[model samples]
Target: MSDRVELELGDLQGGILSAYGKRGFPFGRFLLFHVNHPAAGRRFLEGLRPLVTAALRWPEDVPKPAATLNLAFTFWGLVALEVPTRTLRSMPEAFIDGMAARAAILGDDVGRNLMHHWDPVWQVAPGRPRVHILVMLNAAADREGRPVPELEQLTRLVLALAGQSEGGVVLMEGHAGADPRFQELAALFAENPDGTRTPLPTEHFGFVDAIGDPVFDGQYPGRQEWAKCIGQGAVDGQGNWRPLRTGEFILGWPDEGQEVATMGLPLDFSRNGTFFAYRKLHQDVAAWDTWVAARAAELARLWALPSLEAATATLKAKMAGRWEDGTPLVRAPDWESWQAARDRLATASRAERLAFLTAFTFADDPDGRCCPKTAHTRRANPRDMLDPWYRDPDPRARRGSILNDRRRILRRGLPYGHRDDPSGEHGIVLLAYCADLSRQFEFVQQQWMGYGLDFDAGNDMCPIVGAHGPDAKFVIPAPREGQPPFIATRLPHFVSTRGGDYFFQPSMTALRMIAQGMVDPT
Candidate 1:
């Protein structure tokens, strides 16, 4: 094993390592900008530089800020800022082409997900200004978990600075249909009798989300960090878990492939930097609920389940590879087991609960008995199932997660709009961060989620987030002896792509270089 890489937290952006929602900032707004004057745009970036949050860990004595800010730029945005030609040319092709241009490959070109059907902001019309930069603002909720007044104040301040008469940047419009300025993001919350709100882990589809994010090296402090990597990071044949290589996520470091991939012209320009795929996924809650209800009814009779409630819960768990409460199906295969696990979790310590939720492997459930091979979670990560020697009869011969370690991505962002209003525009703002776009983010989106050949389910898509048509189907293998598999046919399009784009969130050093126009290819 190589020496562990030490991350320079101060040089990296906070959004790369931290999910702001979990850090007390559950409410956020995404603002887009178009730069018309290169020099003036540089001045705008220089003024906002100090406000951008770094990944440095907060001290125990110090309180976190009320809000956090981060910035990213598209390829055209770099050009608008007059970035050196050499540095611009060095960027990956997938990013330079942008998300809309690669819609077909990402399975976003069909039906409502097509480029034309996306938000007007993402569409590059003849007379409209093209999107160049993305500004993310995450604000802390009040004691009652309600939106604070400071959020709006901070948003207005930033908008005014960007749209100032002398500034070169223009705030883009037409997000989320009615909201022409910026898109608002908030997590789902439960209301109490006292009028207090508590954020929930469930998404619009009712499945517990934001679980099992990849743990890379230097993400956490101390020896305990290794313990947190179990089932969440790379695993050896002996089932020993450890944080994945730093280069797998951050630039200018050795990746799982044992090579430091070529970045832009200067090393400082790319070090600690990462690429982001900003996706706005609109979920059709009415369609999802109606489908789940009908499927649960049929499954109740076919599986001889006790009640409609049990069948409903079981069918959902199978589809998501976890119960609605975030319990992995591999850990709690049935309704009774799920209930028991939930009961245990209610009293377990914080550490114990974290272990229970993430510590599980697909080694024992090879045949998709407990969790379906094509289930959303299983297909998304695969864990040790993709190991070269996974099928060896002797468990000792199985190598662990060698192929999967390279494809991991850091997931950020939160749910947007109200979940109760199903017909209203609502879903998740998914942010995926990785060092390599094509190798990591694009590959998973295209191969794993879009196609099912790796799982031996040819032409089938991921039941939950896959881009398959209405004719697509999902297979849930029988869990016990003498029980037949339940096949869901003619699946509906539950999720649609609203809009998105690819961007490079540069390191603090790179930001300074861009702000001062100091980039030199020579």
Candidate 2:
């Protein structure tokens, strides 16, 4: 028995999953620094790599390379940073700074130029991390903003520890696209011709999405549990954490198991390995502006509102169960409530909590009025209102068949993209994590987003953002006991599905092993 167990264990170790779950910060920046020297990339990787990897700890017996590292900011990403806060505090302050200083140390030859840029596809409110450093702050507040002064303070702290550089550049671009400033620097490095230079747009459309999410269990124990299954159990039964044959999220797989490989190096073969499929979706902001402006009166009238802005805000407040600032409508349904709804919701049981969220105007109009049935939220997770409030067609199958482990991806990250709207080219860069994308994420998109068969009999799509053809119609639910259902009206598409793909977030141990060219096919 002992010998058999030993053989089964073989070179396999755990901890990869746990390490990722422990770190809980939002990955504020997806930086891509352009280095002129051949060794620049290596230098940058060396410095940032350690900070990211050193903080990560894996389970025992997992066969991983010494160099691979992973850092996640959100739930999925945070799961990979297994180090305790105490350990992080013990690390040298210099090493905790941004990628620049660390890059300078590893590849001293890379030039120092701070190129600041912004993404056209993203229209985030001003006051967030234009850049990120290793210190903590108060961005966790519901309506809080990340100030620049705070950023400067964090930078000075890094400089004090990491030494000096040639100066730095700031760059921003479409969420995944290149920052204009970064692009300019790149052009300078490559010496591009005058007309050949691609100009950066100040505004655009598309979602600014983050990529690669780690599987989240809980905190410490979650971390430990994950570590124990580095390459064994699926990250969770859901299958979101199932490693690609190449062992992206785990280890102990052979090279051929990978979907792709080159030069003896196992390439990422797992489909949807990248968390968020990032694209700088182009948009005609100017034209969109004109169209909205011209039809402002018409839109306001259709929504029965005083202004288009009010209508938009009204719609948002209803669907999200909160305002754009993250205030929950349930607690502050009156918009003048003293106690915040978000706080209250945070303390309730998972079931009650999900129900309380229905207070959003869309689910239950604050004015006891027109939000109506078949609304977005109602269609997606009808819960008590649609599922419980009313009896199902087949009462026996109601409870069981409805939720039936319907694939449901846990919402784990922020949505990024441009603020401006361009005709029919605006949509969220939906980022979700699941043990199984086929079941959870895809189920919601197919059953809920694509069809209205999940909840009410109304054929309404998400009014504000849902896409229906030129002649799309909304079937409003009847009010009270005897009201007849009404067809609101035929609406044009406001949101369009531009493009999207999924990806996996590997555990640090798994990454290190892959980087080092180690594969255990068995």
The candidate that achieves the highest lDDT relative to the unseen native structure: 1
After superposition, candidate 1 runs with Cα above 4 Å error: 1-4, 60-62, 165-167
lDDT of 2 by residue, 311-353 (tens): 4444444443344433444345333341355467567785455
Off by over 4 Å in 2: 1-27, 31-48, 53-355, 358-373, 382-404, 415-428, 456-460, 481-486, 497-500
- Cα deviation in Å at residue 223, candidate 1? 2.3
Cα error, candidate 2, residue 361 (Å): 16
User: Could you say which candidate leads in TM-score?
Assistant: 1
In model 2, the worst 10-residue window by lDDT is: 182-191
Return the TM-score for candidate 1, rounded to 2 decimals.
0.97
Please write out the lDDT profile of model 1 over residues 1-522, one tens digit for every residue: 435557888898887777988887889899999999998888888878998889887764235778888999999999999999999899889989999888888898787688787778888667978889898999888869877787787788777777663658889888864577888898888898998888876788888787899887788865546888887988877788888888888888888988886677787888888898999998988888899999999999999998999999999899889899889989999989988998999999988998888988898898899999998899889999998888889889988876688998888999998867634689999999888888889889889988889999998988988866868999999999999999988788888899999999999999999989998867
The TM-score values for the models, in the order shown, are: 0.97, 0.44
Cα error of candidate 1 at position 138, Å:
0.1
Alpha carbon lDDT at 167, candidate 1 = 54
lDDT of 2 at 200: 20
